[model samples]
Target: MKKTMKTTTPITKTLAAAGLAGILMISASGLPSAHVHAETKAAASTNRVTAPTVAPQLVTSKTLQSKEKWLETNIKIPVFQGLTDTKYQDQLNDIIESHASKDMDKWEKEAAEAAANAQKNGYTMHPYQLTINYELTSDGKDDSLISLKVITEGIGMNNGDPRVDTYNFTNEVEAQRVTLEDLFGKDYKSIVDKAVKTAIAADQDQYFANEDGFQSIDAEQSFYVADGKAYIVFQKYSIAPGSTGTPEFAIKLPGKGSDKKPAAAVVKSGAYYKDKNGKIMVQVSVLRQLQFNVKWNGKSKTTEISKGAVWSAVKLNKDAYTLGKMAPRSLGSAPVMKKGHIYVPLAFLTDVLNLNADHSKHGQITVTAAK
Candidate 1:
């Protein structure tokens, strides 16, 4: 993502928006004045789990002319989970100071504006709400976790109103702390392999052979498993006026609901699943609709899906080609079949079912069973 200065100014109060609080106090002859009061405050709360409220204090007050240079300060340093208060404060202070020099006034103005807008809309805005959390890893180090919440007041505007627009930016960065001491007798890799195999087997039974009977003409071309997910690639060798050889279709499978009827499936386009090595395992397909029903053991379980939903199943096969890397790029583009496995684009499968691809690296791709 490209970082640029925000075009709109954030709302803020008067003098606070200007860099007047921390400027130097000087006499008429440009001599530094000795009568400057730098207000400071230190308070604590009994509850650590809840957010603490802190009153703002004047760090410095003088009549000196403002310069273009940014003034840096360490507002608060939280030390927890085996981290020293001073060290943590120093590190945070350094980061703030370094970034502050770039455009301190700009940031200050943005912060003030944001606060004012938040209040005008009847929402409470507190500087302390910007508190960040850091976790101390086993390596005796700490990493910052960016977590903030934005609250806005309710509006009575109609459906299409821009005044209610509020953007909340939260950064939940993963910590890079892995321990090798727990790998003594545990075959972590093998465990993952077994999981992948089980997922493939389940998917094959679900999509290929359901109670409705096998819809695939060629069992080998119908479904296959790689990694830990399943993949079902099918093609309709026909075309319509404006459509390509792959006409649009829908996948109606049994939903997990009690209705016992097929519900609309949601599939995402683009890369869906990956392998243990972060290699793309699912590719796009040209087929309009390819349905993968959920099956437990050997019975259909009312769930429906597309090929991209099962990339984990495909990655388990060592011989399976990583989707997109070696497979055809487009439908009617080239043959995706190699040996006995079928290679289809994940996008085609996802589009048919109206599902979004599971692009998350560590999150589960939820597939709802048909109703």
Candidate 2:
């Protein structure tokens, strides 16, 4: 007799709670293969498990000159633990080296710059404070997403205006960060700009005068992925009045038209949902289009997907890996197998199947193109 098994958890609710909080605040803030087989529900009901609750460590630094003296600083930063794969580890290390440390250094430099300006102007520098907070927009076993919001204010030291900016990073395709091109295919730039313009037009009063000012979005523009949606974050005066203060918009296609060209790849969309208990839940979809072979063993079920020499496991309801064979790894997010489709993190696609993936279908998802 064929056996069946299923797994569910409240963690999805936790993710939704976290993401919805950030999404509501847009006004203010914001893979691998492997193979095996399954254990039917009748056999494995007692063995169900949930993905790990991602708790990235934070490192804080504070300095004081004197209670009354000037130049006071405070900084908080996040450090992510490396997933099991080496390729993934390298990516994590790069994120820390390039972003984590660089941001902290930037805050420190600001203190120095402020002190210098005050002394030169013959005015006493008050105390300065910088608070950098991080929000988990999306987390998955194969694909994880997070954003850093940096707020630096020189209260007594200066006029006390906070400087803010946000950065978005995705570990897709195993080649550092997810490029706009990789997500939206080749013409992503122009298509994105047009999309943003339409959104601006819909809310004409919220943006600055002259469409020229809000005409485009460069590759380096500020954006974040939360609750399965892309949010384009603009600077204080980029597209809106200063009072709008860091206005943000959800990137959406215009009436299903020119934006018709889909992204090079569809990633985990960050959409928030509520469970029967009314608790918010986050549902993330990885590469549902990717194909994998499944097999069941005497104990549990296993799913395997591969590209070239690299093979990775594609288990649902647990932390999977990008290169299950290259080394031990986990995607940090949970994937689920519902009906016949496997919803997984995009990490499995780029890290495991990228170049080898043929993806022949133009408008729809393509499966295995090669070995």
Could you say which candidate leads in TM-score? 2
lDDT of 2 at 325: 45
Clashes of each: 45, 36
Worst 10 residues of 1 by lDDT: 24-33
Q: What is the alpha-carbon lDDT of model 2 when measured against the actual structure?
A: 0.40
lDDT of 2 at 280: 25
Q: Mind giving the per-residue lDDT tens digits that candidate 1 earns over 34-131?
A: 11111111111121112212112201111111132121122221212222223433343343333223333443444566666777999865441121
- Model 2 lDDT per residue over 92-130, tens place: 434433433443445455566777898899987655554
Error of 1 at 149 (Å): 20
